[model samples]
Target: MFSWIKRGLLVSTALLSIGLVTTGTDYREVYAEEPLRLSKSVYEKPNIYKVDESEYALFHAVLPSSTDKYIHRDVSSAEVYTNYLLQFAYDMSMLKFGETISKQIEKPFQDEILPKLSEVVAETTNQLTENEWKQVKLSSKPTNGSGEKIFHLYNEESGEDIFRFHVRRDQPPKKGHWFNFHYHTFLDGHEGHHNLGDVYWGKNMPPKWMA
Candidate 1:
């Protein structure tokens, strides 16, 4: 009877160990269930950055400069790292979301802004004759955000070498100040004159009066 009882207790302990392993009841699962992973959606197409790591790093580094005005903090110091992965994940997600909008939707807005803007085309001497003046027109169109206006200067005589300008609405004193964004003279839509890379910061152009 004594021998039988000892064997029964050993068999019961062995069965309990097997049950725990099959049921996935481990300490690691507790932490895993709590959002402890650092995962992000990296947009690699169109060659935004050289490598995927650099793209994410650039986003993380610029995030503070971009968001500091909006999110002011008095903490001694805060470094985003693996320990705060969840919080970092949330912030990083928003950054990438805006990037997607700029790439997919807002970037192609040239068509919408160009047609409505004021245009001025002049002869080689910066002055158009009576008949030549009729060939050129001036117009302006601005979008809602930052009140961005794009200007297109086209000449009827040449009908080429079109100069494009992007002006911001936030000019302090001057309300309708125009600035040059790029100079693209398309060859009848066959070949583009300029590549017009992404405008990360803003219009890297001088003001009309200054230029």
Candidate 2:
């Protein structure tokens, strides 16, 4: 009879907690099953953008000044490697050409130069181990507004440039002007010029870079 009375008190306390068998007014509104109300939808944020790594293109490059951002030793993804390589090249090109020239040359740069970027980046990164690949980085502070120096990919530890990308305004005698895109590799002592093709800008002299 004493054990039965003790069990009755335990069952009564459990029912009183969740408003199912409320003992007072305080417990009446404290039902555990009711959902909490919200002022706004949880997914309604204006500042968020989602990027898909698989379908993503290296169309525009951001965060050019990031320093020594390693690619990580264990990552062997081609998308990760090419995205860094191509985007940095595009970023440097934007810095060199600025708005007007970069827009006009975007077509040729995308078609002609992007292929070379893919080809060369694949070739180079394929030959290296993941540790060596992670050491490679895109350097910052490209020559601004003018000059052929866009940027270079370098070894963060050794501070040596592996590739140098450049652009130059070309005018052959009696020919239309062109913006020439090219790159140099350390293997050739930076002497050999590997062309990435050019965009014709007509007979008139184009505005200076970044103008």
Judged by whole-model lDDT over C-alpha atoms, candidate 2 comes out at 0.55
TM-scores of all predicted structures:
0.20, 0.62
* TM-score: model 1 vs. ground truth: 0.20
- Compared with the true structure, what per-residue lDDT tens digits does model 2 show for residues 7-119? 10111233443444423311111111222111112112111111222332321121111322444333435644455456556556766677777767766676677667666
lDDT values for all models: 0.27, 0.55
Q: Model 1 segments beyond 4 Å from truth?
A: 1-131, 146-149, 155-161, 166-180, 186-211
Give the least accurate 10-residue stretch of model 1, judged by summed lDDT: 1-10
Model 2 misplacement above 4 A: 1-68, 73-75
